[model samples]
Target chain A: MKIGAVIKISGLNKDFPGGVRALRGVSLEVRAGEFLLMLGSSGAGKSTLLRCINGLVAPTSGRVELNGVPVGAGVKNISLREQRKSVGMIFQQFNLVRRLRVLDNVLCGRLYYNPLLSSCFNIFPQRDVQFALSCLERVGLREKAYQRADTLSGGQQQRVGIARALVQQPQVILADEPVASLDPKSARTVMDILREINQQDGITVIASLHDVDLALEYARRVVGVREGAVVVDKAAVKLTPKDIENIYGGAKEQEVYDGTYGRLEYVRA
Target chain B: MSELKRPVLPPTDRDGRRQSGLEKLLYLQRALIIGFVLAVYLWSARGTNLSLPELIEGFPHMADFFSRMLPPNLAILKDLVRPTVETVQIALWGTSLAVLLAIPLGLLAARNIAPHPTLYATARFILNALRSISEMVFALIFVTAVGLGPFPGVLALAFHSAGMLGKFYAEAIENIDPGVVEALEATGAHKLQVIAFGVVPQVLPEFIAYNLYRLEHNVRQATVLGLVGAGGIGFELITSMRLFKYPDTAAILMMILATVTLVDYLSSRLRARVI
Candidate 1:
């Protein structure tokens, strides 16, 4: 099941203003069609890593190559606005244009293909509209196409976010805490959708999750991160209790899975 | 549980003593500020002919003048039709032009939307310069250039309102939810696409609301533009007063008031629909 690397990150370092170092000498390789789940606590640099891959955050000192083409802010990667086309993103906040109809928000995914003047005038091609409608159908939001985005529930909004990303037609999808703001049931629904998309479409899915049990159930590969470094990289089944502790910030406790998904109760060791 | 040893709050007397000193200082500072204000007024009012008695003595003369203007001549209503319409036209065109100009200038001046600091600074400076100059001054300047007409009046109102509208729009843009724009950028969309799809939807309602407010404001301002010979009801008012045609002046004033009131009502209703 070993596929060629689709994203090659080398020595990535991101130092924000006020001297806060978000990423420190991080390096990673994401293989094609790998269901890789990044396990980390808050501020473990997972979000920054995901952002760097999609060219949202520039590395202070590193290289991020998507399909062997360098990409990031100021990297001169994609000429003529072709950047980040291969990398789709799902956000924790869903980030939909709230006042816009769900269909229109989905159509914005095709903005990169249309010219500036036409898109500015809200003139998307007919094929693009059909494609967007299909994407909404895939996410089970075809009935909600005309409703304002803010009117949707959290789970529905995330589904719409998925539809928007699908409209981008990317090779890999980066979901940054995509279920962090969702309820447990909604979390399971979203994870199921991502798993299906990954397995059925062979599109790579990289997700950052704090729910250890859900990650174990859905992800084939687990990468444990601690303090901006990848401390454990192994097949999901191969990870030991120690790896779990490392992912959970060395808490020497047996993490109880609380029967239901998305619930973890730690018993101190 | 009873002997949990309640944490002793730190003694407040020491802090209170220090704060009492601070209070005394604050009181002194407040007195100094009030005294400074009083001194400024006292110094500045010395040569301004501040005579309440003179004003009281002049009030009877004002009453006599007002009595002569009683029962406004409704005959001038026919003549007032053109200039009043021109005043409204000036307001309509001026607001439209301001909206057109403000959209781009506001985008450039907005701290979040601006692509570069230099462009942001330049746009801010331009808007500030325009806002600093009053419409009266702008009308005088334009009247000189275009040689006295409603065109110059429109130009004056547009330039001045664009400055104000642009600032308001920039603030609206700056206050938008950034997550939407970030999502747009994540999809390989260009900057223009982000603005068009993300920023516009969020801010457009507020922008339209601001435009309605500006249009209502501009209607009143348009009447003043004719004071500099820019062609409106203001010229009629000023000329009637100059020639002591008090009845005609009252009619023109009423016409201006009615027009302003009508625009105010319509603009508010439309703004309510948008919001």
Candidate 2:
């Protein structure tokens, strides 16, 4: 019942309205303290699988057990909000409230702990504010904390998002297409932060990625999904580009690039 | 993984022969719509008895009316100040009260934030009912209930604008980035926290801008509320016009114009600075 493996997804199924199935009998057991990447083509159910893990997307059938607590609609073992507290999430869009200061955006991670009446007025406890500031420092963004979220570069914004998730002190972090919107350089910075956290803090990460090079470079384990089903699950070190391409329905990328998601690297002839 | 069967895309418009048959049909459809609109306008014009000759014939009468009001009676200028200021006060109080009323109702009505379908529908119904009834009608009712004063005028403006402002706020909330909201919710922030952290920041600028616009609009509407005996400069102007004191009426009109323009200037400046 205590935290053991971070995630256990069993026979998970999700169907959107109009009977379009996004996930089909997907099952995964994610141990605590590891970097795992899910790879698939667009609409391959990678995002849905991650969302299901955190209870963002309710599975139509099957189950997801987080820290041994079942999560889904109509299952009242624990409240959905309470269950979500132990799981952090990062998004492709960076999802920071653009109008808020970076520090305020980060502080939102502690909103659950902050009291309802005072937090509604943007007043937080001293400890929460300090922790939010420290989270910013971890991302190397303490200097930018007071600036509006919109004022930062895309990469910096993503870093702020990572810091916000880190403040949750969660058992696991689920990143859904975290770098798809960033420039290659920015993408590297964001990935490096995620990797650093996973290694140094022993926090589990289940990230969905579209880039083969990035997944191979950072993830120790990779799972491939094809048409809403888990097709390939293996160690990343064992994967060839061809293997990843197979997950993508073959040869998705013609040109090779650096690990920063398609930024061209100089080949030393 | 097996051999990939890729989707093949054909190059379009190879000969550059402009658009296809669908485009021609679309243009014809647009033309027919314009023709239909023009025909409706012609039909409407008959109902209003609109005629160029009638306008020409009435030109002299309009000129004669203007001639009677040439010299504005400056004697009544000091007396006008009290009522004019009261008009502005009504608008100020009404708009402030509307904002206070709108914020909660707006949150309740917004589809994304509403806790239940029934709550959203009820909030929407209240807002619509308030909006559909004109402020003039509201003033008439209030004036009857409160026995005629600027209090009734203020109440009228506040109720009507609460509806308008609430609708605007709801739209602003609904249109915001849902992604940001999801980011907060995933952290296990409760409903109010999600709104405070995720929704409020995104819509604050729009809320302020719209409120300023409502304040400016309310000022103009307040002046007319006095025509229903609900206290303002319009009450004074009506008395002058009925007494055939056209010069006094002209003076009140000029003061009203000046006051409206000043409020307009102040509202725009505040909007520029804040938003």
Candidate 3:
């Protein structure tokens, strides 16, 4: 009920088309400067949950408050745009516009700040361009600024995604399976960069992950979802093997879940 | 420990829709499409009174025309230069105007960019209406509006070219990655800003290539428009033929064909490098 909580969700219920419920009366809160890992199986609504917070997917019956302002309201209003400006989302696919240069992709985050003609002309202000370069430097890719995004490796492209988010100077970063397509080393590197940004810049990070070990290693808090409900919410340090087993499922339940749908994890057991 | 060999297995249907390597349903669909096309062509030919006997009777006249066309009347080439240049000018001006108008209209027709149902529908309707009428019909209409001149022809070509380019532009816009748009929106970009940054760059090269193709087409079309009193080589050729000056008409036709061919070759080479 505190006024200053960075994110607040109450009585959130989301049902997609065809009557498949992705969230069922879920309620949770996230504080500033917290690195929260959303843990879930393939169909457990990890993506749906992250999307709801930013109005990407509207909940059927729920209230989502970010920085004390409710999402899913009239999009034409200045306030909704303002709220969205502070939240940056990174996708699993490292969805950089492949034809664009790395620096241009990062500078796209300032589209809201510039006039329509300026963006259309692709003319970035000198300071903004310099700031974007620094963000790329933070991801240790300052030298790759001029290269086409498609030319970079998958891991390097994800770093460009991070750099784009950083250039936004967002208050909260939502990463949906940010390292799913990456190799083990790349996954670790991305996680470490996310954690470092959260710690050093005080930028709140809410990342959905299938890897229990990575979640335990980097995230301060872990919220596990099972069948559209938060079954467990605890500090990552306290998340036990028994908790992971429940999250992963027992032999009998695993057979039912695994037969129809595969598990969502960094590595299959 | 007893070692067991895994049983060799044949591949089963992945989605259970397999009927063999060659699908019977696909073959049936193909057959149906071919049948429909043949039936339509046959029916249209019959309805139009397109008789092979009439064509056979006309063969001699065609041969006589070809005989006259030989040697190409190159002696009159000295006087054909000005009209040929006028044709090129008409195409250039018309294409420039169409390219400018199509850039914005195409954006309006794009489903992703034009979120409002009314605007999207209106844009599509306008483009379809423009496309439905041939460029010749557009030339006729413009000639009626502005009186006899290459100016009307230029205007007509511009409008028709806009409609054709607009459709291609809409498709190119629709194919752009939605992620970039989302990223722009998250940065608090207004709708226009989002389109400028996210939509435009993805579709620019395609737009340029399409415009070049339209320009090439306009060159050919402009000559034909002049036949209707709308003022290029076609006008000169038509007048010469009406006056019974067959040699002059032949000279004009030859010049037009040569210019169109050169333009086509140049545009094709340029387009290949754009992508």
Clash pairs for candidate 3 = none
What does the lDDT come to for candidate 1? 0.85
**CA shift of A133, model 2, Å:** 1.4
Cα TM-score of candidate 3: 0.88
The C-alpha TM-scores of every prediction are 0.91, 0.90, 0.88
Per-residue lDDT tens digits for candidate 2, residues B72-144, read 9989999999999999999999999999999989998988888877888999999999899989999999999
What interface RMSD do all candidates show, one decimal each?
Answer: 10.4, 12.1, 8.8
Candidate 1 residue spans exceeding 4 A from truth? A72-77, A250-269, B1-51
B132 in model 1: Cα distance from truth in Å?
0.5
Best by DockQ: 1
Give lDDT tens digits, candidate 2, residues A53-163: 766677789999877778744365577777777788998889999989999999888887777889889998888889999999999999999999999998899999998
* lDDT per model vs. reference: 0.85, 0.86, 0.82
Error of 3 at B98 (Å): 1.8
- Model 2: lDDT of residue B215: 93
**Candidate 1 per-residue C-alpha lDDT over B1-275 given as tens digits, one digit per residue, 9 for 90 to 100:** 13567877668768646666779999999999999999999888877978889999999999998887888999989999999999999999999998899889999998888887798999999999989998899999999998998999899989999999999999999899877877888888878888999899899999999999999999999998888998788999889999999988888889999999999999999999999
Q: Clashing residue pairs in candidate 2, if any?
A: none
Q: Which docking band does candidate 1 fall into? A: acceptable
Q: Candidate 2 chain A, which ten residues in sequence have the lowest lDDT sum?
A: A260-269
Residue B193, candidate 2: Cα error in Å is 1.3
